[model samples]
Target: METTPCRMFPFIRSKTAQSKNTELTVNGSSSSSALYKSNFNLGTILCAAAQDSPQKTAIVYDDKIFLSYKDLDVAARKFASLLMTGNYAKGAVPCRPEDRVAILLPNIPQFCIAYYGALYAGCIVVPMNFLFTEREITGLVKDSEAKVLVALKAYGTEPTKAAKKLGIPILWADDESSCGMQALLSSANPLPALIPTSPDDTAVILYTSGTTGVPKGAMLSHMNLFLNATIVPNTIRPVEPDEETIVLAVLPLFHIFGQTCMQNTTFARMGKLVMLPRFEPGEVLRTIEKYNVSLFAGVPTMYIAMLRCPESDKYSLGSLKMAISGGAAIPVEILKEFEQRYGIAIMEGYGLSETSPTCCSNSVRQGRKPGSIGHPVWGVEMTILDEKDQPVPDGQPGEVCIRGHCVMKGYFKRPKETAEAMRNGWFHTGDVGIRDPDGSYRIVDRTKDMIIRGGLNVYPREVEEVLYMHPAVAEAAVVGIPSERLGEEIAAYICKKEGHEVSSEEITEHCKRYLAAYKYPRKIEFVKELPKGPSGKILKREIREWHKKMKSKL
Candidate 1:
């Protein structure tokens, strides 16, 4: 495939101009001046697209609900009007500018309408995972201090229960019920215009995964979401002006990867989005073939499932132009196999919820490396820094730090945590990585996931990557288990492929061949499947907890 050098933005110096030893940061800024705009609204992307292409199909859901750009815009405006007027039901209060409006729904059309509607009303959007229980919903609602919630009745009574407990009004979006979003939209007039918003005002409060502890809301400003949504697509794919870009939305829209990269990016380009409420490998493959999906963005596990689907050979995924991976580090073996089989490039990127979720990515325009999360996106600078926040040399592993237009405002209502994370003007991502000689970055592992056995440090990704190389290994997660002798011993949880069998000793020997004595997994346990989050990233925190529970029983 043909490739170009990474684009250099006008506002920042080129990576080549900086000394690799003194400043190991890679800059992926382009020459677009709009990136530094002062006043902007996240909702403007949808409005602008609607104005430009009123008849264009904006979203296609399950081959049933097809929304034109104008239709989508009108629905969003109506929803915004309802929020502004507080006329949806009794005891409802008008949502003021910057007020948090939580949304608990799946990847349906209602999610898009509510998300943009909240922003159009100049309200901060708090997108909650629909899978969250009543207690989890209440905790997030209390933390965000959300004024109202837009949820689906089909998701059950949890959302309503949480809203009632908090004394906040909840709007239901049930297609089957009369008291749904459609009824509310029909009764309410369309909002004439979007509320004026400053670029610095928080548009969305995306809570962290809370893998370590309590989830904190990351305050993403209009500018942060705007630039990231604009840069990532232009850098990676660069859709033609007249080209029809069709995207598959299987990843949960509540996640930053799906929100900014898939939804917002597609709208900015006047592209069509095919929505799937849930990801079943067969359904995803069938949809891709049915819609001629040109772009797909998902977590690593999503790719693995589609690749391993038993009847995958029947589907001709020729329309797929590129596959974007994020949310977690994809095993290199899976990346290579999927690419070779599908005849498409998988561009892996890296970021946290705090960075509006995309700081670095492997671009088609900019040459992509297989295992590396390519250079920083346009207007972003990423560098590996030591514990003291000093720049680390190229090829040396350190905590990845980022700064530029895409960094979030701060953790909502948590000044001390924000201060600690944003020390020295750079948002310190707890991910350990090494800067490649070619200006790309490779994630080593999470700082907390690193295991110290005897006196040697071992990255679980390194072990997991090797385990993925084994033929019978269908999925693998490596975690550190407490040890009385070695501080912590490396433990591997694996899922084997169907009709294949592999002993723990065989898996151990496979790792021993590639890894050092201290780095290899000392304990191996086979399971039917590994636990995954909403976006399909493996949940190491849950695995550790399960291990603890089993140990107590022993």
Candidate 2:
């Protein structure tokens, strides 16, 4: 077989552009360790380091499934081979180049294989939340115009029903039965050629939080994701050659924050990724202790849960060096307690799915303020904008806008929405933020979520901060509930610490100490837990809905 000429990613070839201090040999390749690329596809490059140390542990799941770099490559390629060649068991799906393939699997080994394999086969990947219901799954598949569905047997008949309704084939993961990922991986067919895909091509379509309406798919290009993945590791802190960073991957892989920051970054450096299908505080602690994981990227709730875990001191988490907190603005109280408890700092950042989920981040080398999402990274530009879409002065709160290489191509098939978000060459994040004198940005609240109480605009974050100060409060969320007298009254929902019997009266009294009389939550609720999105960001919309229903009943 003759080989066609295909160049590696252009950035890697420019040796002069690379930093001499940053240059370190990796993957047994002459290329600088910072540049991880292959066939201009996100999948192929993941295995480049496997060529160097095929035996280096690539993935670990539940302390049971351990796969080396070589094993991961073989499985990823074999799955890609199955998709491209279409030679598989009866009723298996056959996908052509550029076909949109929806993946609905938990954070299992198959999820990684399918994620990279679909990209390798020149198919656009649509990673659906494994927790999505049948209807939610159908909506995403229909919206993306997916030609096939790759899911797991644990999803029951939801995928089958959705696939049949959509007139597409469904392939199951983990199972060895017909049309299963295991069965296909065991096939004797040779791995297929890595289909050519342009850098501008959309590699993945990540769905945003459907807070306003139906979730829009953010189309991220090959260069969009690849550049962000490489830029993040080096721009923050370059990992030493001998220090193979082990990342605790508890954040759902389907979410953009976890997918890019945790999963993709781990593969770029040929580091070990310890996967957990779900986040159980004790289980996560045990896994971290077992693996000696150094780096962890997680949301605020996960950190809260770990710190609040009664047996947290039992595990020796001294191996942990850094913890990244994103997805939502973490309460300053939670951030401090976590750092104090774990003896590690939490690097907070801000980004949306449309921005490939990370643009502004607290630098590892630079000093970090408790709540401020430190300055824009590398080529990314971040500015606070007024209502008129013009830049606001420093210390003035406004909409957060971002423009950079990490931004998505557009919202898939939503030209009008895309135009609305990408006006004036910047992706307007609906969240409100203010820049401090030091160039760090602090989020006030989502513009839509802000409460106007008796003509006074009260940001929920301000009230939540006071609630977090209460010693009994483990987790807290503040929202605006409709008020007959005041237009909108502040409501605070809190999950108190274990063994602490906190009351609504105590919470309301405590908030009065720090917050202004108008900003204090008059309506205090003690709940077992808050509704969270895939990345553990508390969903305020659900709280509103629940309040409305409860009031109607009363």
Candidate 3:
């Protein structure tokens, strides 16, 4: 392996380049001076760490299945050895750095093994969400043109049949259950050394849920994800060895947050991971109390369910030292109440799939303020830029722009979209927000989702927060509907608690008490469920489509 000088690494680019978009400044400081790189790959470093701490427990599931550092190393090595045999060649013809390999599996131990196995074999991993429809899964696999796929028994032959239809080979880790160490113990060629990859090398290509159009693959490199894995852990809370940091892994590993926080961070620091196949509010509570888990990461809805649990007082949740909420803006009401009830702080962070997911996070050590996503993680530079690409004044809302090591390489094979996103070296996140005098930022709304009612700009987050204060509302999502008078009027989709019902007029009346008359929801639709994306975020685009369909019928 060739070692490159840190200064010469391509990941660290020049910061003084003139911006194609106008510069954004807040309180006499310009966003143009900040720069970042996407150059560190985490999996390679973590596997090396496993060799360093061979006897330490690295993974624990169901409080029974445990794997030490040594055990993980052996499994990965043996799996990589198996992959190296038969028609496999590192950096060979037809398998260049740009080629992709699909990984279709549930959140099992083998998922980690297969993920690292592909990296060890020098192939870019395309992690598929296991719950995706057959058509969706097939579209992603075919679009990415993946050569090999690895899955487990829990995933039936459905994916296999799909792979066969595409003429791609599907290898099952089913033998893992019965074989134990046999496959690993069998002598095979030594695992190859880490491949020489630049900061620009394609690492993982994640496909976005195409609510508006065909799904596009977001390409992230080793450097992109690796930097996030290191920077996020260091920025939020320092990892302490022998601290007994048992993490409850309920978030799907396919999502970038789980991939970095639960898996990579655990390996980087040698912490124990307790895996859950699926999230059950009761099961999650039991696992935490039983394991004395220290670290918990989840979305707002998960926290709401746990706090609202009928037996909430029965569980010993005091063991949780820190929790992180992302995926969407958490209501300020929920934040205050959850902390007051649970005796633990829920730190909020901001990121997108395009940023290798983490850019800013609230600090656990620092006292948190309501409705803030804290400060930028180490090495991240955030700016609130106006439509002209100029920075907004302090406490003013604009599009949230990020420059960081956690940024993804580009949209896979889509240069035009990549160019539009990565303008002037900074990734243009479409979400709008405002930076505080203290450096924290609060998301206002999506750039396109902001409603202009009677020429009064209303952020849905503000309106949503007011709706969340209602006791009968279990889940709520706000969208804009076409209106002849206001151009776009606020329409809300709400899921009420079981045995609890509220009329649209009453809901609107409740909002009118808390919000401006123009900002209050004018139309409401009661639904059993809201549309959600692969990562558990409300799919507002779907809601908009539904609204359009319903209006067309009228």
Candidate number with the higher lDDT (1 or 2) = 1
Question: Which residue runs of candidate 2 sit more than 4 Å off their true CA positions?
Answer: 1-39, 88-93, 552-554
Candidate 1, residue 1: how far the Cα is off, in Å:
32
Candidate 1 lDDT score relative to the true structure: 0.84
Q: lDDT-based ranking, best first?
A: 1, 2, 3
- Report the alpha-carbon TM-score of model 3 versus the true structure: 0.86
lDDT of 3 by residue, 120-211 (tens): 65568899887665677788988898876666546645776776688766565554432322233233333434334566677788887665
* Candidate 3 CA-lDDT value: 0.73
What is candidate 1's lDDT per residue for 1-554, written digit by digit as tens? 11111111110122222222221111232212232444479999999998898778888885766777877787787778678777765688877779999988899888998999899888999999998999999999999999988887777688878888999887887644445566667656566567778999999999999988899999999999998888667887787677788999988999998898889989988889989999999999999999999999889888888888996788988998888899999999998898788888798998788888888999878877988999998889999999989998999999999999999999999999999999999999899999999899999999999998898889999999999999998899999989988889889999998889999999988998999888898889999999999999999999999989888321
The 10-residue segment with the lowest total lDDT in model 2 = 1-10
Candidate 2 similarity to native, TM-score: 0.91
Error of 1 at 526 (Å): 0.2
Report every candidate's CA lDDT.
0.84, 0.80, 0.73
TM-score of each: 0.92, 0.91, 0.86
Clashes of each: 4, 0, 8
